[model samples]
Target chain A: MEPRSSGLVVLVLVCPLAAAVLLQLFGRLDRRLCMPTALAACLASLSLTGVLAGNVARGMPWVYHPGNWGGLGIELKMDLLALLFCLLIAGLASLVLVYSYRFIPHELAPRETSYYTVFLFLVSGLLGLSIAGDLLTFWIFMEVMALSAYVLIAIIDVPHAFESSLRYLFMGALSSLAILLGVVLLYGAAGTLNMAGVLGVVRAGANGQATLALALCSVGFCVKGAQVPVHFWLPGAHSAAVTPISAMHSGLVAKLGFYGFARFIFFVFGTTAAVGVLKMTSVLQWIGALSILYGGIMAILEDDLKLMLAYSTISHIGFMLLGISLLSPAGLTGALFHLLDDGLAKACLFLCAGIFIYRDGTRSIQQLKGIALRTPLTAAAFTLAAFSLVGIPPTSGFVAKWYLVLGTLQARRPFFAAVMIIGAMLAAVYAFRVVFYMFFAPERSGALQMDDVPPAMLAPAAILGAGTWVLGIAAIWILPHIQRFVASLVS
Target chain B: MSQALSYFNLTVAFTVFIAGVYMVATEHNLLRKLMGINLCGAGVLLLAILTGFVRRGQQLADGTVAGTNTVVPAMQWLAVAGIVAITAITAVGLALARSHKRVFGTMDLDEKRNGVKQAPPQSTPNATEDRR
Candidate 1:
């Protein structure tokens, strides 16, 4: 937790904000330069994250009091887990920016400089969400992120996009409202918004309203994470948006919900047997298991490529939830690992979908049959991502799934082990359905003439595909560390 | 005696919440459904205000430690602000819903199952045609 290391945290969070401001101030100077400028900012952040990751690997978390902000102003803290997620986000965001250079032309006009500005703003908010030390600050960053996302989704201006965006807005507002209520109640009981302070109170067995507040906050976070019944809006919103955005949304935005949940369980609720493990005392496991089954089945049935990917996201998220609900160290680590794996795999899938749309001007799986022959590299990337999705050996997805299964065994939750296996099988069905349909299905006459995706797009997809395996092989590299972090936080 | 007053607010809040949930669950009119969701917010705000009573203070003649303090008063004010903000937002939401319905000819999510089907009114096509 060196002071210098903490400085890197502030830089990571603020780089995007500063870039966003620059974009706003001078984005109009030369409209064509927006993409390159945004990419440069993202790349700079990625490099900063690489340095911070090394720092985190060496020691404890580094908390940078921005302007001595932890004492008075806005505090930025970067622990190992936060660093991992931030790096994942920044890295994938860099790729998305790379893709946007080519993809934006197909969907948006040249004067969409403001769009990139808001996009940068959204990234800044996500960085802030990952690292904020206080609940109030966390809530503020969450709102900024959610607001920017709403605008991004609605910007499609296509008919379904508007309605879906409206639905997403309503849902986002509800979650924010619920979170505010929970935070206020927590503040009322604990008399502080600081995570450490709240953790102290909850650990010391604060009763009555504070307990209720914890329950409400958990509910709010679950909604954000797209738990069942509350997840209806995600499919429409994800499917209807532009492709790179779909990738970013699936990869990063949903992880914020898991981050919030992690912060709450570890920081606010503590690892008390009552609150952490037995909090499920009634039906939490059932809820997680049911979502796993439901999201998987529905994903298999989906006809639209993007929509199926969205449902698969729901199913994959269910695995994370099941891992967390196990309330074991292995389980939490598994959940966290899956967050990384799912982000990369889902990003690859969405980018390929974008490539499909780019090539054929259609997103229907049936219409896309045998179209991958026209773009074998894209098809290969799809197969690798699908293998990752199905948790095949030698991919990051397998590492995540392995940990989750081991967690289920350690927790003595055999049913969840079976559920994870079933979820994986279902993932295989939907993921390969798209791939096989794209590559092997009977050829159709007069399909739109298509070309291989440009290097900018192919490069990101290939990197993510490779990362799926690299992370798998090196899963143990981070496992012990992530386990220690989660256990230490829970302890 | 004052407990009864707080209880009344609590009851009213719960009643509003139930009614709001009912509206949201049952209503079909798109605007009405949005209103129902909004009414649910009112209930939540009311409940938040009432929860302050779980630690209410009595007003004494000297107004010593007995009086409701600044914290509760501030939260009450914040709740009021929340109510106002949500109401204003509901109005904006209603306006957006109305316009969307006008543009699409329906607000039923089920009806728009296949997307906006009217083909975008040819989209001022000629200007873009020249470039292609």
Candidate 2:
């Protein structure tokens, strides 16, 4: 089917870019306009994405070419996958920006303008990446995202923040180089930078160059996604950023790496014939499994609340990767669903952590004893989000985990299914430990007298916390569309 | 011999890339690591430039000169943009390292050797207290 040509796709990126530029220009004069402008841009993008999603669901994917450069122009294709990612990025960004209204004033009072500007830039880059139809465009947007993230991570100017941000920058630069090399190699092999053209070349036959490109790209993305061996930068970087930034990094930025990987594996590399020759799937599967166990164990051992949540992000990433590596329709469905579920749950938890820090200035789990009594709403939200992460029944996490297990069984990899179960149990141990500290443990002597945070901050966390359950209950209506998309991808 | 000479730039690119990777992996000093990252970026940009040449040669062999000029300029533009990005990252890295030195009084990343006083994790209570 010929994709319906539309110009509205560009507006999704334009909204954020315009807002960022506006903020950079006049935001200093009146800081009060900053939050409203940023929030408006995000909501505009989210609603635009919702409209496009509706169109895409009606069997008409929108494709836009920005310039008149014929084959050389960049293509922005809004298919089901792209729309799903756009929805997640814009939707979560709207919430995080709302949370930032109250959060940023406390954290970076003088630098609110720069913060919002950079934050909007980051959102634009992520949205651009989701819809990027060619390799070079994807790389460019990836850099935009990475650079903004590096700035946001170090924006606080604390020594540890700078150190961790520097580490992340170096690693990110290396990964970008690796990815660029892969793109160059791919261009050499396929003679085109367009993803559709590359798919055609790969389906004809896999060459050594193509396989090497795949390896380089996969390695780059793995580093970005915080797979086991190269995951050292993640904990420091995620924990060092301000709360909303931390939420964005853990909840959205890291998942873009997985999105890039999925696009390449399913779209560019085609299917088992090419990937099987390299035995890439099983290698990735093993790596994902190792990451799951390592991240889970480390999370359980961490005493710092944010650090524990950061580690759990790694474990959840492993689950998504494992789902993708299974290379089944069911697995892809589970992975995509988990991406949404985990993004909401993790962001909600981070926001809750922010509230705790705002109240008592402590992220130490042991120091947070009986925090529930003071900030009852945040505690309740944290528990619900934690339950989702642990894959308890009637939560969104359970639905995604169920599909992943079913996927493993269908692929005849019962051992991986067992691994998934173990990973969930590990998740339970860490998630529930935080809940236990917040509720059951006795209050410390110096505990601060504080109530729930302002409604601005509390609302985002509460909405996301409730979103996880709502998504779970609504999965019956959602999963079919996801399955159909997954089927289209594999076939 | 002629083929090897013709592909000399590719060889140099790979060599530079490997050297950069080595320095980045082993160097403890922040400045050296930044240099290494720049080198790695330069190598990749060089490789990208070489791709244009390789493509042009293939096109010439196929008796297609219409797109030859276009390919070279496009690659050159890509290289230029890459250089700008590398410079931006270098600037950010340098600024970060400078502040890091001001805060901790050393540019060495090795905690034990430099006896660098590590700041408590930013999210911790003590750090927030310090800020307050």
Candidate 3:
């Protein structure tokens, strides 16, 4: 990275933080400026990311060590993968900020100012994590994300929201501790905090300390990912939060876990198949497989619309984890592609679910029946999203699933291939359950009585719904970029 | 005895972490759970200090070398970062517990869940006026 590009990278990471601070100051003067100010910051971030992506398109990653003290301070690395995620987060966040204009209740006026501040702050954390070049910076940004999420969940101020937010706090604290412990161990083994430096050190040779560090790190990340025992917190957290938040949590926050996992395994560890480390990748595969089946089964049983999407998120996370663990080029590419694919689809799905709740004032799956006749556009948007989630052809979801299945075959894991197919089948079962109820179930309560939600809400969902296919159609170009990214990171 | 002395800090840190996890697992009190989380953070904080402790390159009295030391002052910064994180988390956790207590009149999670207290007053009555 040249000086100019590196400087822009810093701005890209700092823009949201700057906007957040500005919002806080202006919040005292007028409360109405919060949304536009946040949106402006997102625009700045998106443009800055465009510059950094231009840099990434040129060559290998360039680490920008702030203060130029030879990396003694925080280092920010820019690359194709980081740029992709930054764009997704910033772009979606802008839309969410816009959606909050009419979507957030006017009663929460006093709270809305602080909401935008924290919301922008959260966006800063996500962008920071995307480009963080070292584990300490990574952990700090992860904390930022987790802390803001806790506040956002509780911001709804209902009793159930409080309960769920507190539980999320407990879980977040535990995960942070776990990751901190791992970082300490890694420092002990490799005397360096920078991830690329860790790779260099580990490649030189890893003893028992390196092995223990790997185990500790994986445990921390799995908790963040919400694979099994730790995953029980997600449904409650998602259900208790509002729609825009639920979309952010499901779309971007969950994908960040896979981002961290890929960073550690492919970049920091260098993918060299260290004798003991190979075993960890295999273990990751097993965890992925288990989560696939578990998330599928759980989603099938969920009666709440939001909770079902939450569980479906976990299952798709399983697919990404499975892709990363496979350690094949095709698998890594699939994982990255799917991260984008699922983010768009799920954001659309959750936003449409928000419209359902808004129109019908209920989240129960049964109560949502006959909603389609009432609001055909939202129902249509949702069905399109479902097709994406179920991996129907012409959506990005199918492209990602196709590559994932091929990656599994490449790794010679036919069983996981079967798991992918079976999981998608289960996804079809649950996704269409909503569709059938919305369109086919007879109207009992005369609920087809209102027009669709206001366009402020519908526009974002429609765009994201279109994004799922746009990404799919553009996959021919996008997949090659992802392949190049995986090659650069792993090598 | 020599081996025990050589690995003392690592063992102590690990032990503290286990104890914290045990507290978290066994305790139902919300404050106690927060304390448990603090204990866990303390254990990790100790480990962070140990990452730098070997930089002085001292030999044990039993003559076992304390391993190579690179004089990484960066590790101390890591410890400082950990402390800041703990402080923020502690503030948030206390705030949450205070809210929990006001709502339920007790610190037990099970009691809160089982409806031992009155349901919270609704924020917007007409928002859900029609829904069952």
Compare the candidates by TM-score and give the number of the best one. Answer: 2
Top DockQ hit: 2
For TM-score, candidate 2 versus 3, the one ahead is 2
- Kindly list the per-residue Cα lDDT of model 3 for residues A290-379, writing each as its tens digit: 888899999999999999999998899999999889987788888888998899989899999888877778889988878787888888
DockQ numbers for every candidate? 0.14, 0.38, 0.34
Pull out the clashing pairs in model 1: none
Top of the candidates by lDDT = 2
Interface RMSD of 1: 6.4
Interface RMSD, prediction 2: 4.4
TM-score of chain B of each: 0.55, 0.67, 0.67
Q: What is the C-alpha lDDT of each candidate?
A: 0.76, 0.86, 0.81
Summing lDDT over every window of 10 consecutive residues in candidate 2 chain A, give the lowest-scoring window: A443-452
Point out the worst 10-residue segment of candidate 1 chain A by lDDT: A273-282
Model 2 DockQ (Cα-based): 0.38
lDDT of 1 by residue, A382-420 (tens): 889899999999899998999899989988989899999
Q: Candidate 1 or 3, higher TM-score?
A: 3
